[model samples]
Target: MEFKICEVLRVKRLGKKFYEIYVKYEEEPEPGTFAMVWLPDFEAIPLSFAGWTNGIARFLVKVVGPTTAALYNATKVGISKPLGRRAPIPLSTPTYVAGGVGVAPFLYMKEKWGGKILYGARTKEEIPKFIKEEIDEIATEDGSIGFKGNVVDMFFTKPKTRDVYVCGPYPMIEYFRKRAKEIGNIKAYFSTERPVKCGIGICGACTINGKLLCKEPWILMS
Candidate 1:
């Protein structure tokens, strides 16, 4: 995989420590695809592939670690070609469930084909105001928003027929996958963070369920 050194065109702050960074790139990425991003001295990290807006590549970044903090403050960086499976996009409008920064990956899909999203956060303050238009229901553990429970609560409130795409914590993903069968016949896909060192499947560092994360579709459970 080749890392393209690019300049950051802009960094728009979406929430407290959350940023929408625009980079100079020529290609667009599909939903769930990621880029191996890195700085000169920092190790490459896989980041959610947002979208190419007006010819600029975008990424939703949250300050979580030293490298991420550095990215939040960077002007130039290295970004790899789109990685991860190009899972079939839904034909009809789909429903999405997200936790915190998990919403980042679906920005492209939400824009390509309008969809309803059930977003969850710890508090109202943690929710990014910019994503309000895309959210159908919101849940906050602190009850600072729409519902006073988890996104799963929103999922189970009604029998879902629309294909569901979920992203967030591991337990959150597993929880939904377990109960998904009970929620009727809804096709569900997920994207969870894992120890991904290589964007290609050469390294087994990101193996899960006998599948290399770098090559498989996001959170597809058989």
Candidate 2:
């Protein structure tokens, strides 16, 4: 629960509303761990670690609220380590399914295991050009991209049978959960988000079905 006021190394706007903020924070956070990021007078919000290089931590931030918008407007920010639990990384690399900004947490996995990305957005314009994956499968609602439906649609036709890691809206998690039941050998790890008022295990607001996302590594549903 240590906090540091880190210098902002770089900031790049992704698409229209999303941003990539690279901070000079000396924390070796495991993939899927979130940081409690904040500005001087703003509320701290949890942002997943997108990637890290040369002692700098990368965060993919979407401008959704006042706190996030305030973060977008700052050059330096506060970051804390391991706010959330580490996501489960399979012994054999897992298939990454990201809905919108959910793709943030999995960006670093590409470097580690050279995995493929199945990312979904509303349209092609929403896709970030910064992402350079070997096999990036995209799904958009309007058919402006790779597939005309959701990432689950891509999963049904061609089930890879490997472990699958998913992040995004709760409905997307449920969709994959149901699909996992139908399919025989898909191991789905859902990184769910609750109203995490406090990044640490102190606050009980982040509990989902009696399981705290801040304390649990992964929420797996058979």
Candidate 3:
């Protein structure tokens, strides 16, 4: 129930819709956690912890709703107590598979666990230019980027031997989940795309398979 009033340090536009918003937090939040950010005169929404560096908490936000639009315009925000838990570090090298803004959490993840990135987007323009240096492979639906297809298509181009961590749409997550189930040796976990509200778990939203995202163990294993 504790709220942290943080000052928005800066907001940098990454792509057409992707943004990196920085805020000064009193206490640093761990990677893989999330916050229910309350924008002034706008709605409170769930945001994955992108990173925390130099006393700043980073949020990779994509403006998709009126509240996010309002957040995009604000200079200050109210961040609820950090939620969720740190993702387990895989024994083998990690393979981060991200889709669109879902790439947020991996930004923090890649720091501790160095790995390759298999990023997917709709087009070249949709890809965040800032992460160009980190992306090992790319798949765009429009062939305007690295590979001319979706993430799943590129996933099989070569053998994936490392542990897989994914965050994206349900279909994409399900694709990898099914693959892991079939392969039997591929360790995989995915962040759900379910809607989250009332970060305290009072709303009963953001529940997938009876698991609450706001609580510990936010990512689900395959």
Candidate 4:
């Protein structure tokens, strides 16, 4: 449940009010698992692993509130991420649908499990360059990058038959849920960006439907 910071690789600024911090974990946490990051004099928050290799873990953090602000401003701190439910890897080819920071976990998945990735962001500047190079396809809400319009919109144009894995805003996930029904053979995994005060599900901050988002993620079939 506890992890030491092996190294802080890079902290890059993305667009406005966003940063992607790459921290190497002492041990590699499983893909899709999140870590509870501890900041001095502040509450710990759950962050999904963006990518990991050679005892390293990366996280794409958006500075939204006090907890995240403390992390972004802190020079060095102890962090721990208790492993959580890991989505099963598809038996067939996997197509990733990611929007904004929701693309974080998929970025890690792309590294371990080679597959087609479709990433979308609000604008061209908000997109991460590293993700662009790795993904097989990309789309944007604005015409500034990749395809013009929402990432989900592109899905309607060239509907994929492969097993689908997606994470993003609720609207996007809800849309995919409906689309998946029309286009069967698609399995989807989604995560809600709820405030998880206690990573262990004690505080009950992260709950979706009747399931706990951190412990039991909803898996939809279409």
Local distance difference test, each candidate: 0.81, 0.77, 0.80, 0.73
Native-vs-model 3 lDDT?
0.80
Select the stronger candidate by TM-score from 2 and 4. 2
Could you give candidate 1's per-residue lDDT for residues 119-161 as a string of tens digits? 9988889988677876678899889888898887777786565
Relative to the true structure, candidate 2 reaches a TM of 0.92
Superposing all C-alpha atoms, what RMSD in Å does each candidate have to the true structure?
A: 1.6, 1.8, 1.7, 2.3
TM-score of predicted model 4? 0.88
lDDT of 2 by residue, 111-164 (tens): 566567788877888777675343378888899978898887776777474667
List, residue by residue over 60-159, the lDDT tens digit for candidate 4: 8877789877676655656775457776776776778888778778877777777778888878877766666767767877789778988877776775
Question: What TM-score does prediction 3 earn?
Answer: 0.92
Question: On a 0 to 100 scale, what is the lDDT of residue 24 in model 4?
Answer: 62
Winner on TM-score between 3 and 4 is 3
Candidate 4 Cα outliers beyond 4 Å, as residue runs: 1-9
Collision pairs in model 3? none
Between candidates 1 and 2, the one scoring higher on TM-score is 1
Which window of 10 residues has the lowest lDDT sum in candidate 3?
213-222
lDDT, candidate 1, residue 145? 83
Backbone clashes (count) for model 1: 0
Off by over 4 Å in 1: none
TM-score order of candidates, best first? 1, 2, 3, 4
